[model samples]
Target: KKDIEYLSLKNLTVELSNLVFLLEQQKLKGLILDYVDLKDNGDYSMEYNMRLNLEYIHFANVEMNFFRWRDFFKFADFGKIILEFDRLLLQENVLSYIGLLNSYKNVLYLEIKFCNLYILRDFHKILNKFKYLQTLKLNRYNDDRNSSLYMFEAIKNMNYLENLTINLPYRGVYNNSDYFFGMQNFKVLCLTGTNLTQEIPNIKIWGNYTLLRTYIINKAIIKVYDLIEILKIESLTKLSFLDCDIEPCFNYISVELSGIKIKSLDFTATNLDVLKNFDIFKEFARLETLHLSNCNLKSGWLTQTNQSCNLSLKILHYAANCFDRNDLNRMNNLEVLEELNLRDCKFYSCGFFELGNDCKFLGSLKYLDLLHVEINIEDLIFLKSFKNLKNLNLTLSDADFFTAKNLLFYLPINALSLKECNKKSIFENSYSRYLYEENINLNLNSLSSKSFILIRI
Candidate 1:
């Protein structure tokens, strides 16, 4: 009880006053009550008039059928409030819920998920009532009526909102770009499954959002031209396109521009073939982090033409591709690369084990992920060239005890992962299990003499 700083109560029945008393006695910092039935016991309500100050309060999967919502807020003053209900039955009107939230003077962050907010008409207008909210995340289940259309119009005048996320799958939030005509600057804007293919009459209006830092689009339909225009925002740094269909607007012609200051660009699971006309590095000259995972890039994709360009990329994720040694060797311009992820890349019989000899990026790489890429004991010797490599992931590489021992003794990595698959062929063998345990013991003993290393099997 003395050591406990946070308490979690799930799928239980407890009086709100007793819960508060328990937290007060222990001086707990946070509380997570999931699927709990909270009751208002008037017996101790008057005795515990003192409000309990908490760092965070999370209520998830709780059915509000029998719980008194108004009574729950009076006992605690929370810094961050997260109310997630799978199915919420509001006994009172939605305004009462908003009033209860507005009464809380110290809530800085709030997240409400799957609360059927779309059922309430004009629900977005009441959002500005939470004047102290700095970060707000509202996720609604998709409805056929398109109720979320007026969602952005409601938060346009929110003066204190810096971070906002509106995730409503298959919902068109706005019809035109004029929805953000006079909006204040945001630090982060994350929208999933929203339509952003509207035409902008004037590009200068979007430049007003200079304070925007990170923009993330997941499974959204956005045009390539609109994306390029949005990248022109002055302070925007990180941009992610996850499972998004970015249609080419420039008639299959490569578009080039300068002065875009974005640092991180993620195109994970995106259809890169749409933008095959443009050279990504040449287009985003200041890009520091690039993720091109699962883009179906094969051999000869990074050819001599790529060698002529010098890249400023620090991290490169080339997972789930078909790049061989020749393709990797062409990336010699990645001298400043700090992290390289070649996970699930089919380097079979491609002499990738000797990649350290030709790849100039190995010296500067701090983290290397080779998960699911087969490596034998003979090729393991080449990994010694990674002098600055700190974290190495060799999960599912099927290394034996001797190979594992050699890695633990030779590599200067802080974390070495050698995760094995759960197949009966590997796990059922007693000899393999013996070797695995022996390898753990050897690695553990080496940690004492050498620098600290986290070995995970």
Candidate 2:
């Protein structure tokens, strides 16, 4: 009680009276009141003997409606407060919530999670009161289209807000000129979810509207105008179409933005026509990491991409698709690849065999996962060349196409991942059980020599 500076109550189901009694112990520097019972009394404004001296305070799953901030915080002073409450945490009385916000105008950092816009009657009012709020995190949950828009619309007067994280749901791709207002000075922005361009995309606006990086238009038909709009974002860098399906009506979706510095593009689980004709990487000169996993790149799409544009790529994760050795060989064009994940992929013809030239470009590769992949005996030998390899995950083929003893005999493999998928046969478990049956129990550490690459039958 004498030197207690930090106090955190998680999943608390006690009354405010009990919390008040705990507050009798002064000098609390930081307090996290998580899952506390703020609904114990109809009113929580009373005189207290002790003064709450706190710098950081976090309230989770608590309603501030009945809790009068003025009475409780007469002598209580805090700089940072995190309110992680949802619609359920609020009561019918919204004025008390506004009162609580008005009382804490001195806080520098404020984070409100799971904010339902429908219940945020005074959200704009509360925001206006916090003139000193430098950092704000508004994590909205399942609010309606209008409500979500209102929440964004309400974000004004935050002159000090430098960092903002808004992860509300929506359906579109937005440009800098489309929505974000009064937040032009923000340095750090994390839009963890979908942000539609205005409620409607057909609204004709005056020219010279500033276009941000890029926008992801969802559940909408792509037209010529849409394609043109995508190209307008001059500062486009990273693009992710998790499950968006874009029509391949156009024979070619040529992008000629030479200044488009896209470093990472994720088209995983996204269905599109031919990745070849699109030639979307023409202007993606600075593309570093690309994820086209499960993109249905059928057979020969990889070879068609502009090789010069992908030279800067360090991590190429394209797996769980049907492609052959001839197609995989095109990856050799990406001369500076550092990491490659070819797991759970189906090859029309063996994708990993005779890497005589297919494996030449992976000079900088540090991490490789060849789990449950199709390959032959020669492909296993192909791994020795990757000198920069650090982490390796090897899962032998379900079918014994490559019969080689001592499956993992590479030297200097820092970390190894071995997973057994075929439960019926343990003998084929990374060629481990076969050694067990042959009375040849080999310790991995005992037989790791680089100079001699041994393969026994």
Candidate 3:
């Protein structure tokens, strides 16, 4: 073994062959032949010797290009094995690999991502064989052309598995039926790119599984009511919905979630009217953080007649909405409001004026985003009233009156975005002047030329 280690052969095949021969010859204690592409050159004797030295081996990214099935079976009897067959055409070899893995009852962690295991018929049998398996991450690249139905059922039978992350293409038919059945020991369930529709599945069985802590349903069309109902289960504390369509009102929330006690909520790119009813907020008073990005509020007529009743709201985000000045003033009752995001809201002139005064009442506000809002010199002065303001964003150049220089002198912010501002020289001059006078350095980082400047204070 020492002779082979110090040999330093140039050809990888020769080097690996020599190492394998030496390992078997001396009966080595440990071996690591990772990423050494071994070809089947019609010589099965060398492969047999390599497998014989598999008492203690950790193979990683090992290309099994035309390797014998018998050789792999012998290699699978190791104390610990790490197999990586990335881009290997496992059409006829999957059954043999599964059979090999099933023999090893002591496998701890198995991660297979982007492999060509098209037909997973014996997947359940394979999963059942691993009695001591702790973690399993199976991510397959499937599309509309190849829709697999029994994949979920194969995964659901793994009773002893603790953590599971399944990333497959959208299969609405299969997801609606038999996806959430059996084996309820998952602490974290992450379903990515699954075509889950708006209709709620019969997940009454999940309520019995108290171990589930994190549930992430991304790129689906799940309704808000269904989500709230799912959260009604006491164990869930973290929930995230990405690119999902949610109703604007809580009228559809038939089930109550007030007692669920969720800590974190992410409703990114979902509808804003989901909070229209306010019953869910009034129920779940223990909410610490809430995200509502790309949530449109065109229908949320913020007249004195229609005010929001969600008093417990702390972090309010209205990214990519069409809220005016009145909308800002109406949310003054949110006394504990910590962060306010108005990114891409296309704010009019009056919107800035309203924010300057009305926002002062929010004593707990730390982050404020007015990105892409139309603001002038007066608006910058109005922003000074926010004593608790930690961050602020503004337009680089005021088309109406103010320049970057005038805006810089008004407030001492931490980060600034001056991208696409016609007066780049003005910003540099103002920042240099501020540094000379107050001994404080200031720089402007532009988000867009006409859009806004983000300043971290």
In terms of lDDT, the best-performing candidate is: 1
Task: Supply the global lDDT for candidate 1.
Answer: 0.63
Worst 10 residues of 1 by lDDT: 445-454
State the lDDT of candidate 1 residue by residue for 1-457, as single tens digits. 5878889998898876677678778887888988887666555434444467678878786533222454456566777877675554541242355555544457778777766534445455555555567888876534433445455555665667788886633323343435554455578887765344422223345666878899887776667777667766768889888877777675653455567778888888877665556665555667678788987776656552333224677888889988766675666557788988888888744755656576777678898887667766655677887788887766433345444664545654334434442333333433234333344322434433212223434
Provide TM-scores for the models.
0.75, 0.64, 0.60
Q: Quick one: RMSD of model 1?
A: 6.7
| Model 2 C-alpha lDDT versus the unseen true structure | 0.57
lDDT of each: 0.63, 0.57, 0.56
What are the runs in model 3 whose C-alpha is more than 4 Å off? Answer: 1-140, 143-149, 167-182, 194-203, 223-225, 247-257, 272-279, 299-315, 325-327, 330-339, 352-366, 382-393, 398-457
Error of 3 at 101 (Å): 4.0
Lowest summed lDDT over 10 consecutive residues: which window, candidate 3? 2-11
